[model samples]
Target: MSAHQPTQHVASYYAASANPGPERPSVSGRVECDVCVVGAGFTGISAALHLAEQGQSVVVLEAARVGFGASGRNGGQLVNSYSRDMDVIEAKYGEETARALGSMAFEGNRIIRDRIAQYGIACDLKEGNVFAACNAKQLEGLREHQALWQRYGHDQLELLEGEAVKREVGSSRYTGALIDHSGGHIHPLNLVLGQAAAFESLGGVIYEQSPVTQLTHGEPVVLTTPGGEVRAQRVVLAGNAYMQGVEPRLESKSMPCGTQIITTEPLDEATARALLPNDMAVEDCNYLLDYYRLTADNRLLYGGGTSYGGQDLASIEAVIRPKLLKTFPQLADIKVDYAWSGNFLLTLNRLPQFGRLNDNVYFAQGYSGHGVTCSHLAGKLIAETMRGESERFDAFAGLPHLPFPGGRLLRVPFSALGAWYYSTRDKLGI
Candidate 1:
């Protein structure tokens, strides 16, 4: 283990408002379970909850604390879609499979809502999200997206014109928007914490401060931590960007990218309403998007931009605050309260990677920037696969993922250059 442990959670607005809860026990001595999960983020906790509910013995091990990774630090927009656009899916897999994938993506949001309701998780769930377009070109793209979703039987999305979009989002930056009624936002950290608590209440065991350094796959997989080990019938790797040398093959398929976020001090309810009357989450249609929402206590939680290779929280705040001001210059005098950054994994194809290393070792990751709702759906599919029903799991497992072009050491640099090119094109309106 490193001399200094990573901070257990980012200092985001979500963490500050999270429910007070008991810390999970650390793994001590050798233990065994039916399934041993590595990483206590949403995917792991959600899977453990479902597996345990089915009376399976499940143990979840976390390097830091639950929700300490992107699960806690994301933009919190639960948009109902995969990272890949519908057109790309259609181009790659043809219309039928693409439509099926789209429907599954749609169900992802419902899975999240159902879990929240069934587990009684209080995460400030809100309705509606707008994907706003900044330019005429992007407006046309948004219209195409709305049509594609409608073709796939998801007609909940409404196309808002330029003036209507400005009215809806209070931002003249957007020329038009696509409003998805099912898309929404949540206090993500609290959602993860609540899921962890619910998982524990259902007799699932969670071990914190435990990083799996080695895995020996067989009839029962052996997972070794610094202080302890777990031998289980099945292993699920939900670590995503934080897997960190545990699996070399899986590591090459995804790279960690850092994203930054900041929150303003609480505004009066009237001021908050002025900013967003419907409390709908809003994200621009830039390749490098900016997403923001209003908190239950009326603070503006804004997340935008990414730092390719490394992250400096202070610098991130400096860059992001101006972007926030650009969206709502009315809050110029308000104080900025929280700023933080976390790493999320992205696949080369911008699609999730789910497959079995062997028969017993299953991994699900690479949700790109769309993990919030997708992670819940992934958990459900993982649980179902473990129970010998593999249809949904196979759907994602069938997607092809290539290793990063530059190998592990140079992948970050390569990805940084590629992202810069895309961001440049976005700026150039190409």
Candidate 2:
């Protein structure tokens, strides 16, 4: 398997509509920095920007362009919290762990906003995200979700029922919804590209098309690329799903799952408005959920269906188009302008894995399907840990991450079975 992706962004709507960015040269000769970050996706870019703000000389090595991986191609919804929510954290870990996570649950969204405002990043920033419930049972789950988040000091939630829900989301498929005023969406590729620009402005360097082929750990870790080497006091592995052969240790505890997305041809303003009245990003309350939002161009971008173990679907549109039609049958004739798939790292427990390879080599991955917000938070926590403030970072790093029950070879089948079981429950609305 390759250590990273091809040296270019994948062909997706995000890539086609991405902000113009300079093509950085690959690593050449030897360079030294206070920190060397592997992978230029959200985790690496966010960490590099944070470290630069902290007065550290940072260098980011990317296998492809910035945001080329899941960071650039995800659902783009800035949903707060980890894949497993705070309540789950409290239950499985402890109150202390949950409190620490809760304290920073919403910080990622704020950090993103700050980055946009501070750097003048134009990523079509929007506000509000709705957790639409498909059934009464899921509606009750939304109520529980609202209360759970409120207990964590997130008071931006409002439960919408009946007509109230339609006012926010035009989808009649929803029985009710929970609106998180603070949650929202963006052009994910543009957002990461903008952050990369900001990092460069702060004197941080990023080398595109540079994959770390060899890592030698020491006081000054050495990361060897195809053309050159980077030596730094510490290294951060932030490639998430794309960081495959780069670090096998991190790979052992997580599996990469692929999700498909498709964007319809641009709709007229009226049509788009009717689809999503308030233009808020929406995701159904299912174990295998369907998420959709109206793009700035008025196209409906819908995504769902997972191919466990990073297997690409034969036809992304075939899998996702049906899901979209199921939600909005009125779009039966709408043309799909773009379709693609991206991988998200999933842990057995559905939480992110944050820990150190050693004292100086840290890693944050396995965000499950909640990388947009959690990846940014991971960057902040990583910078904090590197700056000798490990209290907040340790909260996540302390959690145990178990490998798949069947190991790498059989992990796919096992995960597929688990997904089938949960998806069945979702169908039964249990």
Per-residue C-alpha lDDT of model 1 across residues 98-135, encoded as one tens digit per residue: 76677687877898899899999999999999898878
TM-scores for every predicted model: 0.97, 0.98
- Model 2: residue 304 alpha-carbon error in angstroms: 0.3
**TM value for model 2:** 0.98
Q: How far is candidate 2 from the true structure (C-alpha RMSD, Å)?
A: 1.2
lDDT for residue 207 in candidate 1, whole number 0-100: 93
Candidate 2 local lDDT, 47-122, one digit each (tens): 9999999999999998888898899898889999878898899999999989988999899999999999999999
Candidate achieving the largest TM-score: 2
Compared with the true structure, all predictions reach lDDT values of 0.87, 0.90
Q: What is the lDDT of residue 338 in candidate 1?
A: 90
Full-model lDDT, candidate 2? 0.90
Residue 351 C-alpha lDDT in model 1? 95
Q: List candidate 1 stretches off by more than 4 Å.
A: 1-3
